[model samples]
Target: MIPTDWIYGLIGGVMIGAAAAMFLLINGRIMGASGLLGGIIDGTGKANMKERLAFIAGLIGVPAIVYFTIGAPATNVSNNMLVLLVAGLAVGVGTRMANGCTSGHGVCGISRFSVRGIAATLIYLLAGGVTMLVLRHGLGVI
Candidate 1:
């Protein structure tokens, strides 16, 4: 039988897609969080610094607002501070190497029918799936 988590996943996917679509449609720019945040920090976004700052601030603060309004998310992450730091650095490196985050390439880029975006999305998914399989099944980490 299909897992019930799949329904929540589908809803999340739909919401992400819709949000990315709206962001691009309104801004006429890619809805890439990393790029947006990076540009904001570097003062190189297409818009003025104030606008970029506002966007970045909104991105950071809106989730907290929503979580407070609803409820905080539960996570099963390890409590190791060193591991978390290394994982975060690795993710930042991967995002740079991939040229975009999953939301940017998988949702916004794919919506624009970019071949590179599609390939990157497939590679990202395949790599993640393989890594998880190896970690859980082969290494028995989970």
Candidate 2:
């Protein structure tokens, strides 16, 4: 039998896909988190400040509201601040180099059958698997 968590995951994935579709159709923009946040930070999103702000607000606010209402979700992240900071910076740089992130490449890009998106998604999955193998088994640092 399918696990309860798998059902929840399926529902969440559907919701995310719907949200991405709606964002693209209504805003005429890809719902990429990295691009959205980067544009705001770099002042490139000034022309659509309201829309960007609304998107960001919803992104952050909805999760906070959900956590408060339904209780905080569990995480298994390392407590090391430096490790977290380095990881965050690495992801930022990687996304900038790739021209998009998981949301853009995996969801929006793949849905539109984009070559770049498919390539980036594959690279991301491969890199993630390698990282996990190295960290969890080779280094025992995870």
Which candidate number would show the highest lDDT if scored against the true structure?
Answer: 2
97: Cα error in model 2, Å: 1.8
74 Cα displacement, candidate 1 (Å) = 0.7
Runs of candidate 2 with Cα error greater than 4 angstroms are none
**Worst lDDT window (10 residues) for model 2?**
69-78
lDDT of 1 by residue, 1-142 (tens): 8787998899988887777777768866677777776666556665656656676788779988988899766878988787688778877778767778787887877877999889989988898899789977999754
Q: What's the CA error at residue 90 for candidate 1, in Å?
A: 1.6
| Clash pairs detected, candidate 2 | none
Model 2 vs. true fold: TM: 0.95
For every candidate, C-alpha RMSD to the true structure in Å: 2.7, 1.1
Q: List the residue pairs that clash in candidate 1.
A: none
* C-alpha RMSD (angstroms) for model 2: 1.1
